[model samples]
Target: MKGLILKDLITLKSYGKSLLLIFALFLFLGLSSGSPLSGAMMVMPISIMAAYVTFSYDKLSNWDCYACTMPMKRSEIVIARYFVTIILSLLFFAASLLSYLFTAVIMQNFSEVYLLIPSYSVLFGLIMILISLILVLNYKFGPDKARIALILIFILPSIFTALITQSNVPMPVISESTIMLFCTIMPILGIAALLLSYLMAAKIYQHKEF
Candidate 1:
């Protein structure tokens, strides 16, 4: 399992320079706009993109077929991918948080930093759920078709949001307790989704003819 994860990390090493550039760009944007959340908002999508690139590399190299020939269990392969995705997500989150803090310091608005914790926690949970769905799609459909599905997954949300904004639907007012409850529940749900996704991917890979 360690070897499998190491291989994926090595494959992703080529992305190092690009990742740094993106971080610097977003950091600058946050500073210029005086909005730390702008930098933080990039975390989920960037992590997802990086994670998907690993899948693309695996497909191009026919890594799965070769992996299956080895003595490792199919479930381990799925787990390794999940681990890599999670590690990438956390790394990006840390970078975004640092950017947020730096921007807050420059703006002399450190008071708002604490306010971001709950929001960021919720965002991280949602990101996990999104990555879970991506993993299942990639495992079941292969990377090529999965890319199309992923595009639709992202586009439909934007279309729905646009419709909602055009309709001018009044947003509901919620109590602080309600918001806290939601933040608490979402991470638990995200964890459940991730576990289920792993099981589904393992089952798919088990019968998959590589």
Candidate 2:
């Protein structure tokens, strides 16, 4: 498992420059706008894209074929990919949080920073669900349809967010306890989705001919 993860990190080396540049741009945009959710917006896509990039790299390198010839279990490989996605997503979230904090310091207002906790809950859950969905589709359809799968992954989120944004319904004012409870519940659901995704992917890969 560790070796598989190490291989992904190495594969990501070539993509580092592009990811960094984009991350920097998003960080700048978030800071300039003084919006933590904007910072989170930067984090979510990039984190999901990182997983896609790794899978693309593996396909291009014929790593899957080679991996089957090795001693590792297919389930382990599937789990490793999920682990890599989680690690990269968490790292992106940390980076986004820091950027928000830096902006808060400059503006001398920390209230917005506290709001990030619940906002992050939503963002993180959404990303987990989307990432897992992408991975499962990729496993079922294979790399040949990966581009289409990626598009499908982004479409639902875009439409949902758009509807929420365009709606005339005013935002609700929830008490702190309610917000905290929501934050706790959401991440648990996200984890369940992630685990279920892993199981489904593992089953699919185990039966796949590679």
Candidate 3:
């Protein structure tokens, strides 16, 4: 499993230039916006993109077929992919946190960091849920179809946001207690979703033919 994860990481290293460019771009946006949260928002998409890049590479190389010939179980392969996703999520989350801190310092708003902790935690949870969905879709449908589905999934939020902005409907006022409850529950739900996704992916991979 470790070897499988290492393989994915080494493969991803070849795309270091592109990733650095993206990082710089987001960092600049964060700095320019002067909002640490804005910079941190880049965490989810980038991490998801990294995960999909691995899937694309695997599909291009027919990696599953080759991997099946090795001694490891299929479940291990699925688990390793999850591990890679989780690892990438953490790495990007940490990077975003650092970016947040840097932006805060530049803006002389370091005190807001404490206030933003809950938001950051919520973002982390959302990232996990998104990654879990990506894993399950990739394992069940292959990367090509999964890409289309995920694109729609990504677009729904924007479409909803646009509609909400144009509508006369009033937004509900959420209390701090409710917000706290949501922030606390989101991570727990995210964890549940990830474990469920793992089970589904393992089952799919077990019966999957290369």
Candidate 2 on 1-210: residue-level lDDT in tens? 999988887777765555556556666776778764475467877887886777778878888899989998999999988888888787777777776766666667676666777888878887888888888888888766876877767797789888989996688898989878878788778888899999999999999886
Candidate 3 pairs with clashing backbones: none
For residues 18-118, write the lDDT of model 3, one tens digit per residue: 55565666678787887766876887788877777789999999999999999989999989988988887777777777777777777786656665779
Q: Rank candidates by TM-score, best first.
A: 1, 3, 2
Best-matching candidate per lDDT: 1
- lDDT for model 2 comes to 0.79
Q: Assess each prediction's global lDDT (C-alpha) against the native.
A: 0.84, 0.79, 0.83
Candidate 1 residue-wise lDDT at 167: 100
Clashes of each: 0, 0, 0
Question: Which lDDT value does model 2 have at 165?
Answer: 91
TM-score for predicted model 2 compared with the true structure: 0.85
